[model samples]
Target: MSRIQGPEPERRLARLFRSLAPAERETLLAFAEFLAQRGATTPEPHGGLREPIPVPRPTTESVVAAIKRLSKAYEMLDRGPMLNETSALMSAHVLQGRPANEVIDDLEALFARHYRDYRAKHLSEG
Candidate 1:
């Protein structure tokens, strides 16, 4: 019988990536960043969500503004899961008087995690 050998894993991945659209390629890069961060002992507090570098708003910037800014910055993320966490953080800020910056920090982490999750799910399907 003739022997058969599958292509190398790297080769397979290259082929898969090459077939993706530009938007999909960006998703793949985001996914790669997520995976790389997963192995770190202390992941950057912001995760990979800081891309485009959020403009520095004054301390007076409303919590709502921060949420809107973050949502715009991470438009690639699936919004369903994020809505829940975001609502809770908003409540904490509005009802419990949590600091705006503190809430925004949590929001950043939440968006990053959701994007990572989104990437993982989509990558497996593709």
Candidate 2:
């Protein structure tokens, strides 16, 4: 507790959080939890990333469902770098009238690519 800088940042965060809509607040909290988990976890004893937990995609899925599936399937990968692309694809589906199947296909490809990159980087580092 004493290591915490102060309440200034927490106060600021509270103010910003209060300004967001319910959905946006949920998003903010999820991102914060993701960050906290990312910092908390360490690699396995083998000095490599944990194997991805496979969650098979269902037929005729929604974009939101795809995002959740991919996030689970590729849990070993750092999602920070994928956020921009992920959000863009999500927006394309939600706001730009993109097809759900197409968006989900792109999302699967994006997660696969990120996993490949994570493998190379972690393997080389190991």
Candidate 3:
């Protein structure tokens, strides 16, 4: 997501797209249209459509960059109790027939070790 700044929203949005690639612009347009339609068709208390509220999508280049940035932050802050909860959620997707010890090893190597590295790589940069 684009960071909030002091400028008016329209001007900020214009500035944001100035550096985006063509494909990024197209993706943002599509997402904007989808959001507009979603807002327009929302059910009202009286059983009618609500007024449309348009939302702009961030450029794909910016969006991808933002995701990468946030992913690193999430990995950094996520340790101990928080990571344990997330591990339980992800473990459900593992092969059902796997033995308990095998699952433990897989989780330790994939989630724990990788997260340790993820933090080390991003701690200074982020």
TM-score of each: 0.51, 0.66, 0.29
- Candidate 3, position 40, lDDT: 42
Candidate 1 ranges with C-alpha deviation above 4 Å = 1-60
Per-residue CA lDDT of model 3 for 1-126, tens digit only, reads 796567698787788778778855654554444333323422335532222122332333233232223233333233433334433433343324434444434443444454556456555544
Tens-digit per-residue lDDT, 1-126, candidate 2: 365578998999999999988755765665565445444435567775777788888877767667777777777777778777877886686668888899889989998998888888888997
* Candidate number with the higher lDDT (1 or 2): 2
User: Candidate 1's residue-wise lDDT over 14-66, tens digit each?
Assistant: 89999988755654554444433333423335443323335565667666666
Better of 2 and 3 by TM-score: 2
* Per-model lDDT: 0.64, 0.75, 0.41
Clashing residue pairs in candidate 2 are: none
- For model 2, the local distance difference test gives 0.75
RMSD of each: 16.1, 4.9, 18.5
